[model samples]
Target chain A: MKRLSEERTKLVFEKLTKYLGDNLKVLIDRPDGTYCFRERKDRVYYVSEKILSLASTVGSDHLVSLGTCFGKFTKSGKFRLHITALNYLAPHAQYKIWVKPSAEQQFLYGHHIAKSGLGRITENTPQYQGIVVFSMNDLPLGFGVTSKSTADCKHADPMSTICFHQADIGEYIRSEDTLL
Target chain B: MDVVNAILEKNVNSNKSISVHKDLELEIDEGTLLASDYNVFDKENLRSSQDTYLKNLTRDNVQVLINKIWMLQTERVDEAIVGILPKPVFVLPRARSVPKPKPLTKWQQFAKEKGITSKKKNKSKVTWDEELEKWIPKYGYKKAKADEQKEWLVEVNDPTKFTNGEDPFTASKTAKREKQAKNELQRLRNLAKAKNVKLPRVGIPSTEHFRDARQLAAATTIARASTASVGKFQSRLPKEKDAKDIASHVPGIKKKRKEAPLSVVQEKQRNKKLAESILRSKSTILHVDAPVPSTKSAKSSNSGGKKKSSKKEGKGAKKPKGGKGKRDLRSKVGGRKRR
Candidate 1:
């Protein structure tokens, strides 16, 4: 698959915006090591330790980078960002999000991995390819893309995100469905 | 010894018939005495019921013979004591008690006379009376005309279902009786009221409240005569409201009034009236035909000054000429003599 461009990411964001009505949040990690979050207009923004920790992982520099990225993606739509719950609660991101694609948008297979900020890291890494999937952690122990297209992108290193690939995503989604 | 076989059989009997009866009673005494010193009979005594000497002897006699043998050997009695004894005697077993017959009850006798044995159970059979439309007892109904049955068929089912539903039929009968009673009571009430006889109070606590024919007639008469009929027809009213409204409608019965609230002027006037009344009673009020003032005039009258002067004069009049001799009657009523 080709790298997700800014335009393509916007289309994905736009599709995800539908689910934002259904209480899902969207987030992105920038190359500068900072993070940005997306929210529904009706919902109040709450910065919990979890989002703060995720932002810490991207660092303040990456946060600024993610802000620019998100700004470019969401040209017209508005959203609020919150950095909640530092370190102790970053991995729960996948289950809390339920993205609704527009009737025309295809249901992206690895779209959920983006919520945990792993996709940003994996898409930028030289060793990654295709779409990276995130599981329970930001560590490289999980599965990720192993294609040259994803590796050669001009984005920051995505090794941390790529490690959490499809298998991890499958495990997390199975557990969540079981809980339901 | 010389004669030897002389005359041996000189006279051998001409003809002889021989019959032998064994009367056995063995008595052994081997010098050293012991109760079981020797054996007499090897087996149990033989038993016979008829009278051949052996037949005459019972098993008990045989047992006695064995005990004698032991006794003779152990006690060493004289031969004469042994010889005097006849054949052995044996034990006789105890007889069993006879069983008594049970007496039959009258019902059982009637059952039998009808050829109905206790062992034979009679099942109920119901026959349809076409004319009156009821199932009648099959056997009993045979004597009665089909047109005479007055009962109507309420239900019909298989014998099993019929027997199981006996209790429900009984319940229906009781409820029917109750409904009949209620209808009769309503009928009686209507007739009594039409004749202007009071309908006795239906739900009162006293026993007379029961609306029997006589009481109903009496109550109706009373109500018709008195204007008290205003509260009589309350069958349509809700119970609580009817009871409350009925009391008020009863004529010539006055409800007690609540105490009046007195205004300041009225209160002062009342006090003044009470004081004057109290003063007058002490003097002019005690005189015969004094004509007590009405409540209104008493309030305006000033009797206080005149009452005091009159009281002094009254005291002087009351004093006897021989002052201390007579007891004062007025003093007995209101003076120091009244405890």
Candidate 2:
């Protein structure tokens, strides 16, 4: 396989830095033909072999996939986090909602979670902002959009809906399987 | 002379006509004609006449007399023609006529009578206030309220609410960062909770043990050696070669071979042949005119000359060999060039 050119590597780095952060370190291996990333704290993450191979099929206009989650690098050089990317970003992310097992199933099935099923909601989460959803076991379920403000969520009824699920593994699988 | 006397006798009988001739004779006798004055006369002989009576009659008075006689003859002819010919008939020009305007439609007529210009009214315009940092309606309270409500509805899903000045990508980045920070805090809290609470361990052990056939054989051999002999069966016995040799016999061993160096003469000859071959290949590909390098001195001299000539040429013009010009000619002749 041909290795990425210096210009392409620089473009990828710029995009990743904008989306991920300024502290991200991207390394390209010419011999092995692999891409790897390290955060500010020196935690290294490798681009999945599957995604690396998929890079060949991607068009010139397509965004680069950074990690296993295939978090896309937009044309504007910002990273749009996919649900799979949450596994890598969960540790460093700010707001998270721990859902009940039932709610987790519902969330993966592409249904929004109600306030009652939420085990915990982080403080100061703004309304309509992007958020990460996790299961009871601490596995990142998916990403979601907050439907209510932090203050509103506090005073609202227990059954009131909190977040609208954005992306999940179940949705990805459904999209991939033609038989469905 | 008889004709002249007849004309004079006829003029004397008409006293009114004779009165005009008498006035002409009086006007002519007032001026004394000169020789220079004769130049103004149309007839050459009349201008050079020495008779004083004719001299007193200037060219102007003679012309007036001729005009009066011509006018009298023309007037008599016109009068006789008018008596015989029929009168001409004239037609007067008529004024242009215009068509009446079409009757207006019922709605148009009603609108005209009511003095209503248009059916729809001008909507209230809204402008952004720099001081207040919000959009304000130019009209009344109702319009302002409506604008506010519309703004509120749009603001709900507005991604730029928090990141107004930033681009869409940067705005999304800020949102993602905010989300990540929240998740990290929650994770830390969960980690604390797990530390404080005593949770039961679940699932199978992470590490696994496997027994290989070779490992089993080696273990048995080691056990038998320990039981049978203390110092007899060593890993590397004195009778055996090194472990590498044993590994080589096992299979998949790559042994490194040392290459032998060529003699000076052979090396020189080989290098010369290689260089000649390279030059030949290059000449074939590029169609260079220079001969192949058989000897070092000849090659060096040729290259030096070529460099000097190339420098003199600077950037040479490209020759269109086997190109459009040649192809067009070959096509016209219906013949292909040999490769």
Please report the candidate that would top lDDT against the real structure: 2
Give the worst 10-residue stretch by lDDT in candidate 1 chain B.
B313-322
Q: Write the per-residue lDDT of candidate 1 for residues B1-339, one digit (tens) a residue.
A: 546555444434422212222355334232322122133433334323234434433333544444544444232366444323333343335497665544444455568788886564776587676765677766554534442334334454446445555664565567769988987876666566546687544464455573575554444444543654554553432332212233355453336665566533443344334434433453342242133334223222323222332222111112211122114534311111122
- Give each model's whole-structure lDDT: 0.34, 0.48
Model 2, range A83-149, lDDT digits (tens) per residue? 5555544554556788998777877887777887788888755444446788888888876655554
For model 1 the TM-score comes to 0.15
Question: Fnat of each prediction?
Answer: 0.00, 0.00
The DockQ for candidate 1, computed on C-alphas, is 0.00
Runs in model 1 deviating more than 4 A are A1-180, B1-135, B138-260, B278-339
Clashing pairs in 2: A19-A79, A93-B180, A93-B181, A93-B184, A94-B180, A94-B181, A94-B182, A94-B183, A95-B182, A95-B183
Q: How close to the true structure is residue B156 of candidate 2, measured as C-alpha lDDT?
A: 36
| Candidate 2 per-residue lDDT over residues B1-339, each given as its tens digit | 999999999888755332222332322211121112323333655656656446445444555544444443232374562222223233325476665665554455678999978755875477776655667777766654654555443333455465455455455558779988987865655565545754444575233221554544444344334534532554654463323333343332235564455433343344334434433443342233233333334324434333322222111122112112223443322122234
